[model samples]
Target: MTSQLSADYKVDHFQKKATVVGLVGAAVFLFAAVAPYIFATDVTSAWIKLFYLISLATTWNLLAGYAGMVSVGQQAYIGLGAYGIFVFNDMGLDPYSSVLVASVAVGIIAFPISYVAFRLRGGYFAIGTWVIAEATRQIVIRFDSLGSGRGRSITTYTEDAIYRNLFTYWVALAIMGLAIVATFYLLRSRLGVALQSIRDNEVAAKSMGIKVSQTKRIVFVVAAMGAAAAGGIICLQGLGVASPNTIFGVNYSAFMIFMVLIGGIGTIEGPIIGAIIYFLMDYYFSQMGLWYMVVLGVLAILIMLFLPRGVWGEISHRFNFKVFPVGHQVQPLFPGIKLKKK
Candidate 1:
């Protein structure tokens, strides 16, 4: 009875924590989506930019932090996802709905490409991914329909302007919420266990009957899909104007990695934390000019050298804090061993 009661208490504790996080996350997004109307024009633009930061960090977290895949070429999909939507909208589809199409399409396209890239390992894999992204950019640049290095935009949404702003806001929020909830749920399932196992030891997991390539490929595709969704929504919010350079810029990749590393790699809470800090920095130092990018580089280097496991990881290890706690713990020292402290 006591053991059962203890387990129930643990479950309840977890539920309460998740509820709190969910409500807080929802509130933050709500404010962001509506901030444009409540504040000065300049302040509104800043908050909207923060949404892109959050979206990128979340997508990067899904990849490296969770699935343990690191690719420097993710901007390839971001560029493609952004550019892809404008094509749909030009053909008379609603720009917002095109975001979903671009996301799924990117996922499908990335799958077979993963087979080619997965052939390499470690540093080679990383470079190969970047090469692919560069090639993708070059291809888009050759197409005049995509503005050929210049940006192109949808003049109108086929669905008309009736509640377009609200629709875009809801869609962006929906994508963020979906990624968060889906990631948490996935991590709770056996798939999550499999992913963690892969992260810990790929060879050992394979030896124990895990389908290594298939799992990695699936995760890679899913991460691409999530990133694509973010990119598409971002393009929509910018009025269906997809600029290849801005969306596919290497800086986008760098920013995402910085946010995840500084926040806490391998944990859900870490990337979001890192992103908020980045947003704050962008807000303050933005007027300071290109020095902002320099600052980001220095900050990332400092965090890595000083707090290797990242902010949240360090905090958790040092004090055993579990703000986003998902693991289990035990009370007694052994299954049937117990002693009185007194």
Candidate 2:
């Protein structure tokens, strides 16, 4: 009896457009990193806001898009990060150093909270997280050392406004860059594959021996840390104010969900596109009072009706464009030659 051998198969994770897009993206980020040196102070501040928003949205996308963890309590981490800066500053650490410390501390705190939060699933899970965040906010409001309900400022690190703006801008850029890079690598790894699998079908993935709970816990902690880092930068950018109501507000999560949904939920480019759109809308129409919100709501509805998959998702669907290619592409092992199985 004769035996047949199977032909070798190859997979291409990235498309041709990815290389061009990647190079361009890197150049743009480099330019952005030095924006404080090249651009005016107002422009640098605007870019700082953009970067932090992008950071927050990116982490949220990782959690909701890839991990299927629809959390509305990320603002908790943002608040923690912001307040953490105040705590660190009170301990005599510099503002920039405070950003690092606060973000790490929030990340560590998220791991323990995951144990409690992970008990619920689906919509209940989301509500559970929100309740935890509200509880945290209430608890924080009672701490007189943190200014009670009034809030506090990082006073020690306000020596130079110009220097502080520049530092905050740079840190924001770094956080956004790290988030994008880290996410790209994570999606390309085996862990990312498993994460996506879980997002698609939890039961199927669990049956395949994937550690669903553990993997989700990792994602939750990472997302929390990222949002916290953004919060730290945000507090610094706002002249070191750590206002509880503003930083820990539900509005932050609402904005995050809006950006991700409008941009494209499951794709990497979606959040970036969504953030840019959101920033532009806010910058140009923020002065229009209630009309501004009306316009935003109308636009979001239009995108939902027409695009469905989001702006980036629709564009990708139409033109097959993939700036950050995460899907697999299969081709014949031998170009221009077909092999028959024997």
Per-residue lDDT of 294-320 in model 1, one digit per residue for the tens? 888898899999999888778877886
On the 0 to 100 scale, the lDDT of residue 236 in model 2 is 89
Q: Report the C-alpha displacement of residue 109, candidate 1, in angstroms.
A: 1.2
* CA error at residue 70 for candidate 1, angstroms: 1.3
lDDT of 2 by residue, 1-342 (tens): 754322655667675656766788799888887777888998888888889889999999999999999999998999889888889888999889888888889999999999999999999988888888888889878888888898887778757778888888888998999898889878878889999999999999999999999999999999999999999998988765546888889889988988998999988989999999999888889999999988988988999998999999899888877678776666567666564532
RMSD of 2: 3.2
**TM-score per candidate:** 0.85, 0.93
Lowest lDDT block of 10, candidate 1: 4-13
The deviation in Å at residue 209 for candidate 2 is 1.3
Question: How far in Å is the alpha carbon of 59 misplaced in model 2?
Answer: 0.6
